[model samples]
Target chain A: MAETRQWRLASRPTGEPTRENFDLVTVDRPEPGPGEVLVKTLYQSVDPYMRGRMRDEESYAEPWDVGDPMQAGIVGEVVQSEADDFDEGDVVTGNLLWAEHAVADADELRPVNPELGPVSTALGVLGMPGITGYFGMLDVADPSPGETVVVSAAAGAVGSVAGQIARLSGARVVGTAGSEEKIDWLTDELGFDAAINYKETDDLEAAVAEACPDGVDAYFDNVGGPITDAVWPLLNVDARVAVCGQISLYNETEVPTGPRKLSKLIESRARVEGFLVGDYQSRWGEALESLSEFIQQDDLHYRENVVDGFENAPDAFLGLFEGENIGKQLVKVAERGE
Target chain B: MAETRQWRLASRPTGEPTRENFDLVTVDRPEPGPGEVLVKTLYQSVDPYMRGRMRDEESYAEPWDVGDPMQAGIVGEVVQSEADDFDEGDVVTGNLLWAEHAVADADELRPVNPELGPVSTALGVLGMPGITGYFGMLDVADPSPGETVVVSAAAGAVGSVAGQIARLSGARVVGTAGSEEKIDWLTDELGFDAAINYKETDDLEAAVAEACPDGVDAYFDNVGGPITDAVWPLLNVDARVAVCGQISLYNETEVPTGPRKLSKLIESRARVEGFLVGDYQSRWGEALESLSEFIQQDDLHYRENVVDGFENAPDAFLGLFEGENIGKQLVKVAERGE
Candidate 1:
């Protein structure tokens, strides 16, 4: 038996998360049962959406109980295996724990192809966030050629992929970020037509309008709040808005109040639909295949903000709320087994 | 030439409309030229949607320019025709002015088949409101059999038809209306599974939840504001909302704010789509043919809140904001040609 150091929910967060919300503990790692593989975490994803799961309520993801280890998107090496599909030293990815070692059923793990790109990319642009952007943009917000597509949280894992995909679809892509670095990355690197640093803009609506001169035709909304309020009025006739996430309101202890917009929707004949990437479980292959092609062709770009050491997982997770990460925020637990 | 008594926009209204916003003008009736017909106005629809047009901004319906006669769905009779399609004394329906008489291009008019039902139905169940209800219910908020469907403004022209159509689809129909009279009409006359007088109810959310034990599968929203805010949480997984009208907010002077809801939509994977009846112009024949069949079979019921005389057209239009009308609000301008 080996030792596993893991992060657990010490308390449910109030308002915004603090370091006191989590506890890092070491435990005796157990042996794998039949049809299971012992995965040693190399990289684990930290996302803003995990904030919602901390609450004691039913949501898209199940709530986390106090004192229980939190689960997240993890890319790991198979240190030991009792399953036929995975060999020792094979790199795999699945929804796993923020621990150094996790016992997962072989069926739940997907083999990460190092031949495609870095194995860590599986936890970022080639995983749930990427799939979310793909399905939400293509299925829900179906932007047309020459139309303006606006994405919020544009430097984050999902929005970066969404904006690039919209640009690839022959639409002009506009994005809102929090820093000048993110703005530069979105416009200079990712080929975004316009990138607005919301923290720097005084009148967000005016900034969005100036960026989208013809008004927004499609909107990929990830951080809903005042940002969404600003985008509502600028929607052109027959616009499409895909509600992918509402990270801004995830930690609010009380209900948020803002402008009512059904009247705006009616006049524009627009559509606002909420979607989850899990809904396309049958089409994961299709999404990954296309996403892999984009990466190979150098059309899609990705960045990973890594925090070394497994014990620092909670800090990495908490950093998401402060907009500390430029792209996918991940905590590295160990080196990959060769 | 006959002197035509008509109402024109005196000024763009600020806040709620008043008498000062309109002017009653008497002008010499103009003659129809090539490809036109002279129609003697019989009935003119006065709806809540007209309030949006009274503003000076572009909307689904173009803004009514100050000092110009406003147009609506009018059931009229052709007195004289210069076009080959129309004959004298033929009852027709088209978008026409609020006047004693107006000339219209023949291609813009659809001859009302009075042999099927009363001529007044051309302004209610056989007109734009009916088609709006039809496509909105069937195409957007597609409720399955045994599913629960809730409609706001249930006693209004569009909502009334929407409920009946949902009932015809074999779904459980619930409605929210203003008065006890309207509630009874929805439950007893229109065959809604449950009806709530939103004005009378203290806890609307509880009432709606009790009525829909399985949660709402589809929502046909006509009145937006607190009424819609109540139905947001009761939505089931994959719920669909057809944003047909927002009569409740049409009179709002400033930006209206309430609890934000994009988070709830994301959790439920629900869809809210705003649609205009004009978008389905190509499918009008299909809608009318099915709607006419419903009328002939007595499966659908409709009511007209008729304000006698063309002189009271402004009063009828304003009454909609006061929630005075039960169903289609129309001013009877004249008798059909003998």
Candidate 2:
């Protein structure tokens, strides 16, 4: 039997997840069944939303049970195939096990186009995070020309793209990030009109007010805590808020309390909508096409912070909460098979 | 010159407004200017939204400065007119001063149809509250047939109509109110599938869950405090929440802190929107026509807690915070002209 290394959930974290919550073990590599393809992992995605699946709570993502193999979006090369659509050596991407080798249904996997960009982008800018930001900004928030748009956690994979999309629409874009490097990346590289280093600022509201002098017409919320509380009161009348992620509250054992904001929504007549990228599955092709064109034209830029080795996957996931990654955080599990 | 009694803001309330915040004074009845009409107040609206105007903070409704005459939706008889649209003894409704008489541009006033039930319906079922519920339910939190719709403050003017409208759309309607009478009015009178007396219930979430077994698909939020917190977790996938009023939080001296809910919205992919009736001005005729048809067909029932005298208008307005009125709260100032 062929042996494969895999990561499994050792236990659920009470608050913030640690390296101890994950386990690495070698197991017998199962052969592909009918219509299944055995894939050798190249890169796997680590996202803020994955924090939600670690807990027992019912959320949009299914919770991972203790002692179970962890799963994530992975771009890999097909080593063996029982499916007619996939052949050995084909590079494909799908939600798969965090392992050196795993079998997935061929139907679930998408063929990665290396021609569009780097194959690693299949798990970053050209993948789930990119589509999430694309639909969330252009469709949900729908910022207009000359309007002010603010994006929280703006140097992260999703927020970075969301802000740039708003800027492309001719909106004045403002972004908030934790570090000075992230702030500079948002303003200098991403074409954001302004960026606020929230960790350095004593008053985020005043900082945001200085950045968004016209008031926020559209807000892409990724971290929902004091940053969101500050932005809530500054929303212009008829503001549109795209509630894509609440990475700030994901690790809290207890539901955190904050200033009641529905009253402010009424004052601004704001529309706050929570959405998942999977909901726009039918229209994802539209996003991928636009994102690829923007990338090829040098209009859209993306960053990847890749951690080498399958054993380090937990560290990369844990680092997300510590603000360690600048953009899409990924784990390079193995080299692509020939 | 004839004198008319008017109520002015004595001082901005720090917390809950009191009778002392109002100063009743006799002032000379204002004369009509060109394109203006002098309207004698007959039925003055005392609504929960008026509490927002009393604050010094900026809101959708213009804040009343200290000693400024308090203004609200008023159904009155035109005593004099300098415009071609209105004449003496013509019953009209407009956002007018809370007094025996005040001057308003003829363009701002809408002619009241006495044949459409009582003329006071112009301030209750056939007016702003009716129109608010109409659009908020039909347009914002649009419940599909067989979907579960939950309405908080379900016996109040906007809520009562909102609940009934959801019921009319073939949705399984649930409501929450303060009193058993209000509960009875919701379930028994307004055709709600279930009604929870929030004042009597120890666990509002459990009560809401029991009432909406399939989970809440739509929520018409009139009071946003504990009731909203309870309903937030029960939202089904793609639920819509129409935030019309936060009467529960309106009286708080400071912004109240509660369990953060944006995360729950992400779990359900729900959309929460805050809207004002004034924004739908161009299409109000559509609401009025539909509301009138529903009222005349006995498909919609309305209640009025008319405080008999204008001297008690402050009391009527104050009572809204206490959940005193079952339906519309109005102050009947005078009889229609002979």
Candidate 3:
């Protein structure tokens, strides 16, 4: 029997998750069943949304039970297959176990096109996060030319792409991030009109006001806390808000409280919609096609912070709350054809 | 010159408005200018939205400055006209001053059809409040058949009509109001599936949850505070919230704070939109036509709480915050030919 290392949920976190909540163990790599492919893991994604799954409550995504094998977006190479669609050494990606090796139904896996860019992008810019930002910005927010758009957590994988998409639509884009490096990446590299280092600013509302002088016509919200509280009052008439993620409030054990905002909506006649990328599943091809063209033409840029070893997956996920990664955070579990 | 009694703002209120905030004075009735008509006030509207205008800050409607004549929806008989569109004794409705008489541009006034129930219906069921509910329910919320729709302040003018519209569309309707009479009016009179007396309920969330076993698919929000906070978590997937009024929070001296709701929106993929009746001006004829048909066919019912004197107009407006009126709150200023 082939041996594999798997990460499992040792326990659920009360507030912020730590390494103690995860357990790593070696187990036999199970044989592929009919229409299943045995994949050797290359890279696995760590995202803010996974924090919700750690809780024992029902959310958009199903909750992760204690002692169950953890699952996430995994980019891997097919080592063996009982499925006709894949063969040895073929790179693919799917939502799979966070392990050195795992078997997935062939129908669930998508063949990675190395021609598009690096295979690692199958878990980053060319994958779920990229599509999430694409549909969230273009469909939900729908910023028009010359309008002002603001994106919170703007240097992260989704925010960076969403902000650039707004800029491409001819809107004046402003972004907010925690660190100066992330701020620089947004304004200097991502073509954002302005970027606010929220950690360094005493008053985020005033900083946002200075950046968005015309008021925010569209807002792509990733972090919902004081940053959103600040943006709520500055919404222009008929403003559109895409509630993409609330990374700021995800870890709080208690229901968080903030300033009442629905009153501001009436004053501005604004529309605030919460959406999941899976809602646009039928049109994901449209997002990928556009994203690919933009990347080909050098209009869209992406970055990754790849942490090595399958044993370090929990730490990479924990780092997301600390704002430790500049872009898509990933764990490089193994080399292809290992 | 003939005299008319007018109400003016005495000063902006720090919290809840009081009788001292209004000054009633007798002034000479003004003559009609070009394209203007001098209207003799019959019924003046005292609504929850008027509270927003009393504040010093700008809102969807321009704020009324101290010493300026308070303005509201007025149904009156045109005593004098300098325009070809209106004739003397023709009842008309417009956003006009709260007084015995006021002059308005003929273009701004709509002719009131006395045959469509009572002329005061121009200020209640057949007018702004009616159209507001029509568009907010059918358009913004867009409740479909078999969906669960929840309405707050459900016995109020806009909410009564909105809930009925949802019921007419074949959705299961639930309402929340302050009094048992209002609850009875909602479930018994307005055809709501369930009604919760929020004032009587100790656990509003549990009450809402119990009423909506399948969860809420649409919400018509008239009063935003604890009622809204309770309903937020009970939203089903893809719920729609039409934010028409936040009467509960209108008089707060400072910005009110409550449990954060955007996270719940993400869980349900719900859409929260704020809308004003004025935005649907072009389609008002469509709304009024449909509403008139519904009324004529005995499918729609309306009620009015007439406070029988103009001297008590401020009291009528103040009573809205206390949830005093059963239906549309109106001040009967004078007889049609007084």
Candidate 4:
């Protein structure tokens, strides 16, 4: 490859991120060194968490430096390799550049099989979001049989898988989302017992209360803020909440305030915990196995909102906050043999 | 017994409770019925949680009826018995009335020994607060050696013991209190690494950060609201917070609002759990055994702010919110053998 088109961080965002904060640039594609593979990007994952990386301040993940090409969970095919770990035709997925072609260490590239599922799925249900939903629901939330589990941002990548996993645990699943389409996708297609269109609902607490008559036993919180506040009063005794993501607060310039629910937690003897998929790195194979099984058995349904072309990648990332995607949001950078 | 002096619920208070909410009355001593025993009150425990009972609303515990005498965890003597289980003169502690004399089901009373420590301790260290600290600190928070543990309301009955327990686990204990005397007791007597008089501290978060330089690993929270708001930002990765009580908000007429820290939990991957001592009913014996050993070995010290007369029971209970009591607040209805 002569040139690699990439989206680089132009500046740190103040409030909600904009296109001006990113710059599209073309750089000469470097040759693969020893123990490295050159890959042509097939699909690129865009997630809400990437917003945190755009800030200059320190957070859980390191800030993406200004003028650096942004990195994402990109699935690509190896076009050139100098390592025994990969062949020229091998399909791989890893944390790589948001570009048409990039060089990565062979060890960083995880091989993906096109025989098992669609190649693009390695960026969504078969990858980070899937494993995140897997561990967070089963290990963190730990919902039991017949218990009511409520999930926020239900049609999103992590939340969608989390709700499905809760159902597999014999628990009643209720989901909250922004659109009727997402709500339908959750309840009608994904097997959630109830789905509340939070954007349309005037009284969120009442909607949640009606959906979870028995009170929420477990909560998979993907979008925090008001959604979590609504879930507070309805928590059953010993309720467990897994804080997966807080996309609602991610774009906010000022810290938001609300009715503090520590007292309510005490009254209910409930628990709220936060987690990141990266923390469960050691046990990912276990999660991937279960997620793959669920997908192969048709027990887990997957969806994606893919934006076409490398030029539209930044918009694909920004669309997360606007509730523009139904499931995992991704960008298609190139053809299979580009 | 000729007369039993008692405090009955006169009216429910809207905000902070007042003495006018209670009515002191003299009644004829009650006699034991079948399967019951007549108890003459000795040490009467007054806790912040009792404030919730005074409200005529649906909560975790049943609301105290307006016409009935306010009940509490009372240590008393069995004066007369119709039940074979409790011998006359046996020192017992149970959920009993504010009156000096009342009938209790034999099953309600738990036996306490004067030989192990002062029978008054059954109202403080060897009782509910002790078990609350035991389970909240050890079981829920689960602080490890070399970790920093912060306990709010750290001079109170539960918080003091919880901080001590964390210290016993080899964690550096940071305590927050309201009085200089209580601060002295926590740091000098109880071996707390640092104590902040939250009332005098201009910047609570800064003070907490200074006290817990390594960041908070475990937090035993008895006082919630702003004190908790300060601790949220200082949480280390995988921190455990035991929400034992929200004494600060117990009297709030409206739900108090503050910076929502749910997003911070996600960033730190921390866990906050609430618990009542009653939830560990099956494990009371284990807690008691550990508590007694801590006291017997002189590893633990206890303090009680004793109100000398039955007339002051309501005052003692009200003093909790004002930070009047240094340790366990109790009303001494009569002499031990009265």
RMSD of each: 1.5, 1.3, 1.0, 1.3
- Give the runs in model 3 whose Cα sits over 4 Å from its true position: none
Candidate 2 per-residue lDDT over residues A1-338, each given as its tens digit:
88999999999998999988999999999799999999999998888888888888777889999899988999999999999999999999999988989999999999997666689998888999999999999989999999999999899989888988998899999999989999888878889999999999998899999988889999999999999999998999999999999999988988799999998887788999999999999998899999999988899999999999888999999999988899899999888654
Candidate 3, residue A265: the lDDT equals: 88
lDDT at position B40, candidate 2: 92
Q: Rank the candidates by TM-score, best first.
A: 3, 4, 2, 1
Candidate 4: which stretches are off by over 4 Å? Answer: none
| Clash-forming residue pairs, model 2 | none
In the range B1-338, model 1's lDDT, one tens digit per residue, is 57788899999887888878889999999799999999999999987888988988887788998999999889999998999999999999999998989999999999997787878888898898888899999999998999999999999999999999999999999999999999999999999999999988999999999888999999999998988999999988899999998888888889988999899889899999999898999999999999988988889999999999988899998888888999899899998754
> In model 1 chain B, where is the ten-residue run with the lowest total lDDT?
B329-338
- Best TM-score goes to which candidate? 3
Candidate 2, position A59, lDDT: 76
Worst 10 residues of 2 chain A by lDDT: A113-122
Compute DockQ for each candidate against the true complex.
0.84, 0.84, 0.86, 0.86
Q: Which lDDT tens digits does candidate 4 get at residues B195-269? A: 999999899999999988899999899988889989999999999999989888888898799898888888899
Query: Candidate 3, residues A1-338: lDDT per residue as tens digits?
Result: 77999999999999999999999989999899999999999999999999988989888899999988988999999999999999988999999998989999999999997776889988888899999999999999999999999999999999999998999999999999999999999988899999999999998899999998999999999999999998888999999999999999988988899999998888788999999999988997888899999999999999999999888999999999999998899999988765
lDDT of 4 by residue, A1-338 (tens): 48888899999999899999999999999799999999999999998888989988788989999999989999999999999999998999999988888999998989999898788888888899988898999999999999999999989998899999999999999999999899889988999999999989889999999999999999999988888889989999889999999888888888888898888888888889999889988998888888899988889998989999989999998899899999899998888875
Model 4: which residue pairs collide? none
lDDT of 1 at A271: 89
